[model samples]
Target: MNGVHAENLGARKAKATRWGTAFLVATAISVLFLVILVLSIVSQSFGYVLVISEVDTASLARNGVALESQEAPALIETLKEGLTRRHLATLEEAKPLESRNREELLSLVMMEIVQERPARTWTLVQSVFQRKAIFDFRDSDFPDGRLYFRSWLRASLLANPQSSSALDSGLRGAAIGSLATILLTLLIAFPLGVAAAIWLEEYAADNAVNRFIQLNIYNLSGVPSIIYGMLGLAVFVRYLEPLTSGVLFGAAEKGAASGRTILSASLTLALLVLPVIIINSQEALRAIPQSLRKAGLALGATKWQTIWHHVLPASADRILTGTVLAISRALGETAPLVVVGASTFLTIDPVSPFSRFTTLPIQIYQWTSRPQGEFKNLAAAAILVLLVLLLTLNATAIILRNRFSARRRTNT
Candidate 1:
């Protein structure tokens, strides 16, 4: 009997050892792939490009000092002199050209007037190791072209607006549209989802109808996002066009369509994330100890009062963990927004919730689908911007979660 017992214990120990080794290997593989992805994105974001403006850059220079070195006012004057009246008016309509800073005006001058475009490009690795070879090839093959070390990721990418030329394009419009859409989605979805979760976790009786609803909620979370886009197209865009388009409120702008505004897009995203929030919130609420409720009841607190004051505060951090996940998913979603009518080539910023919109994901998609190497570089830079924005939002949520955890600890 002693020998058999010892053998059983040894077998259990061997199994545990195998499982631990497997888990460690899995974790190592995940980290390795993550590092590889980061390296690949960084490789595309910095390099050397052969830039050749159609017009000689020095011809536009102020007293041979260079056009790029000019002041804002001078650059604006140059734009006025070089651009057509219609083109000038289009630029002014977005923002008063005079109000733009020096660098922006310079970009405009280079893009619109000089027509500077990337003629050829090389990756950072090639640019560094094959410097002599690249220069020799450039001089022999295309003497008119000039070489410059260009970092695709730059301050200008964030500050400037979208453009027909990849060199002049920026993510300002898409970023602003993303912020507006995501914030509004949270406002519309968070409360409703939490309320549904509370009902399901605290009040709903286990019955056929309730079980059906629970099953549907779980299933909805896994549905393709594009389905929500179709639902929004039918309901918000077509059926309730007047409301979503702001026609009912008499707030529609000159060119507002039946729908397809940020409001419609946000509503679609809200539906897409609703199940995720509810499931997470329900789990959070469930984790709170039953004794807390009993204690509240013993103190003569009503069920509603206990839930609002005690139960919710205890689970706030966990609930916010779900919110962070939903927000991250919404930030990177492209197909739903595309199907819901996100403008693919928009330059002007959305002025209101009822305005047409786009997002970082959409911009990245469009840029990547193009045939140019420069556009691919731009796409890589946009991915970095999206990652930074996601991290910033997640950091903010984490701080709030920590505060809630601290407050809950103090209360207990």
Candidate 2:
């Protein structure tokens, strides 16, 4: 009997060890997958492209006169002299060189004067592993073309406006629009969500009506975000057109007839994230010690004063964590904004809440839909930018949370 019992116990221990190993293997696999995904995106964002120019740089830089050293007027003259009449006319029609500053003229000289266009592109892996193949292919197919490895995510890519051409396109307008929309969303959602959470968790009676309201809030958090977009379209875009379009404020631009603007998008995203913020904040408020609230009331403080001075300060960090989650969800959301009429091809930055706009997600979707290979690389680069923006926003929120937490500790 002792021998049989000992063998059974040994078998059970071996089984438990197998399960632990399996769990660790699963976690490692998940981490490996994430690493591969990020590396793939980075690889696509940098590489070698076979670029051919309408005019050679060496030809333009003859007589020891480099194009970069020239003044605005001289750069304009050089551009005109180097570029064909048709190309020069196109550049002038796009934006007058005469009105542009020295920096702008220099960029135009490099871009338009040289007229660089990608003939063929290679991913980072191909550029690094098959450098000889890339150069040979460029030399054989297009002798005039140059094979250069370039990082697509340059400062100019963030500075310049969107263009039809992949080489000339940038994220300035989309980035600005994203920031404006997110700011508006936060302004609208955070206070309202937090206030609702405080009332529900601290002040509201545990009655049937309040319980029903809590249930609905939980349900809303699970509803599809695109449904919120549709709701925003029906309400903010149509019913509140005059308000959202800035017509009521007398700030509407001429010919800007539609209510499909950044304000509507922001409001739509706010609605989408409101339930998340409220639920998370309720949990945070509930997490505060009941003893602290009792102590404030024991000191002859009213319920409102107790909450404002004690409970809120204690729960500020967790409340900010909810805000961070809400912002993250809103940042990556494209469907709701799309339904509320985000532009896929906006070139101009949004001047106000009522202006037409596009976010980075919309920009990435637009680029990925294109047939061009280069645009896919651009889309990958845009994804990286979107990730960076989300991280920056979360980092800022975390810093604020930590500051409040420190203050609370010092006060206590």
Candidate 3:
């Protein structure tokens, strides 16, 4: 009997070993796939640098090559006058190719020289440690030998709206518009959501009114965002256009009903995400221990005071996590913004609440759909930027959550 029992234990150990091996193999495969995906995106977006150079007309004549009319000397002179001394030096040091050989030269330069500037560096005695910068080449693919990478990135951020030309692809207007919309959305949604949640969870009796409202909140969260876009069009732009005249525009400016301004879009998004924030806050509030509430009551504290001091403070971490997540979702949304009449191009930065706006996601969408291969790369780089922002926000939330948990443990 003892021998049989030992045989069964040995079989169980063997089975566990096999499962562990399988798990490790699966993890390895998943990691390998992720690496391959990243490499593929990098190769498609950044590996190619488009080149359009003016051949040296004299040299072309000497070499019996057909002249393409453009003068290299004039272009070079203009570039030298415009660019800084260091930039000109860098351009001069970049090995040149006759116009025909530009593609090959550009490939070589990108492979060897392109690098981003790091944020920080540390030195200990004679040694230095530095964090290498990661370039979003996939987003800003400047023409080889034509413009410096840093110049191109700055141009994208600074340029005003232009036609469907690469020269016009700047983030100035869109960036400002996005900032305004998000600020408005936060202002409108945060209060409405938090208040709704507080009312539903704390004050409202468990009855039909609460049930109906709770169900509708969940339903609203699931409603297609474009529907809210339509609502904003009818309600804010048409029905309440009188009140918004001063708010949407001043004496020199004009506002339209076609969903052109930041306020309209923000209201649309506020309605879209309000349900999510409400649900999350309610859940967080519900999770707080009833014992804390009872103790507050035992101390002769009012219901509002108990809720404010004990319940909210305890659930603050979760509420913050939900807010961060909702904002992240709002940041990535493009379809509703598109439906609400976000422009594909803008040159000027939005200066006020009534002004126009564009977002990173919308910018990325515009770039990706364009025929120019460079735009596609730009879209990829923008995607990476958005991903990094989301990661940073989530990391902050995680740190806060950990700190809250630690404090709670210490208090207990």
lDDT values for all models? 0.90, 0.88, 0.64
Residue 377, model 1: Cα distance from true site in angstroms = 0.8
Give the TM-score of each candidate.
Answer: 0.94, 0.90, 0.67
Clashing residue pairs for model 3: 138-377, 139-378, 139-381, 160-347, 161-346, 161-347, 177-357
lDDT by residue for model 3 (1-412), tens: 9999999999999999999999999999999998887654544333323243333334433234333333454334434444578865654553332442433332222222221121211122111121122123323543233322222333443344433444334555666676678779989998898888989998999999889989999998899877887887777656765443334344213433344667777888898889999999999999988899999999999999999888887888888788778877887788888877777775455666566567778887888897765565556556666677779878888888888878877877
Off by over 4 Å in 3: 1-36, 53-164, 243-259, 410-412
* Candidate 1 global TM-score: 0.94
For candidate 2, write residues 142-211 as lDDT tens digits: 9988778889988878888888878888999999998999999999999999999999998899999999
Give the Å shift of residue 235 in candidate 2: 0.9
Quote model 3's TM-score: 0.67
Q: Between the candidate structures 2 and 3, which one is better when assessed by lDDT?
A: 2
TM-score of 2: 0.90
